[model samples]
Target: MKKFTYENITHAKELNIYLEQGNRVLGALGYTDHSGKHTAKVAMTAGKLLKKLGYDDHTVELARIAGYMHDLGNSINRASHAQTGALMAFQFLRSWGAPLEDIAIIISAIGQHDESNGTAVDPVSAALILADKSDVRRSRVRNTVPETFDKHDRVNYAALSSTLHVDVQKRIITLEVELDEGICFLMDYFEIFLQRLLMYKRAAEVLGLRFKMKANGSKIS
Candidate 1:
């Protein structure tokens, strides 16, 4: 087996451009934290999930990198961001000497991250989907003015804290969220995320884990 390291890539310029483009677009919409902060969290969480599940270190590292850049397609457009991001990631990974098989896995995972348009077809894809969708919290938008925060951002603002934990021993994936009603109601968050949560359920099923949720200390399904 060979190893592929993103550190050796000389395409930081292009990667930075992609990141900036996503930041700009999300900012224009007054979204709380769709940029690097959330993406970095997703990337790190994905790697952790794979690592805990006994995946190889190299594969875990690939998950980390894939999660970080999974939303690069949003730089072009939001409608089909995942699909476009897969192509972008594939091209860059190939240039970086990533093996063809690994490249395919990475690209597929990136393309299917959005539950609105994708399904978990592999372990990596399943892990990526769960990691990306689990990130929701009020800390992501504490800086945004209340008056300016839209419903999407307001839901994030209402979430005082959020954590996603995987219990490998119990084979359970749990999402715990603490919310503040002064900012937004819990129903608002569900209204936006129920579909995504359904996708997470499918992703968890692929990993043979039960998906559970606890919001404000109350069990949600």
Candidate 2:
């Protein structure tokens, strides 16, 4: 069995085109940037989440690999991107000579990252869930024309900065954000992200941690 590291997959060069094309597919549908920026953020955060909690190096690398490829299925269709993305990653990793055991973890993490049809299924999946959902920022809004922005776009655009921090010692994971209330109220954040927070709480629990949220300076969840 061969071992493939995150650095190897990220530097492959050939995979860059697929990630870019996947972003194009979402862009055509008026979605936020799910391209390199979003995927890279998820990959880094997922790997860090596991590493901070003392997961094995190989498992941490697997999380990063899964995070990077999670959105590729959006290239084919967004409706079932998680499921499709998992299959796509499986093929790519298998062809690249990744161990079948490692591929199993990566594909499972990719397949279950979406909130609509997925939950925290394991440590890696939970980490991916928390990491993917934590990335909310104004830069992710691809809809430049504010006049045409929807609730999702407006809320995301209102987020000036967002950070997900893990306090492993305290067994807590907190998502802190600074939002421009003039553009969108705190209520707007909850309106769109309440379900996400609930899901996040569940994910954190899987890692033996409590999930928290702070908007501006107040803890809301």
- Top candidate, metric lDDT: 2
lDDT of 2 by residue, 5-31 (tens): 787787767677788888998889998
Residue-level lDDT of model 1, residues 1-221, one tens digit each, is 03456443313677868877977776675556676688778888988998898888888877888888888887888879899999998888877677888898899999988878898988888888988887877766645567877687788877778888889999999989898988788898899888998998999898889999998899997
TM-score quality measure for candidate 2: 0.95
* Candidate 2 global lDDT: 0.88
TM-scores, all models, native as reference: 0.91, 0.95
List pairs with backbone clashes in candidate 2.
none
Q: List candidate 2 segments past 4 Å from native.
A: 1-3
Task: Work out how many backbone clashes candidate 1 has.
Answer: 1
Q: Number of the top candidate by TM-score?
A: 2
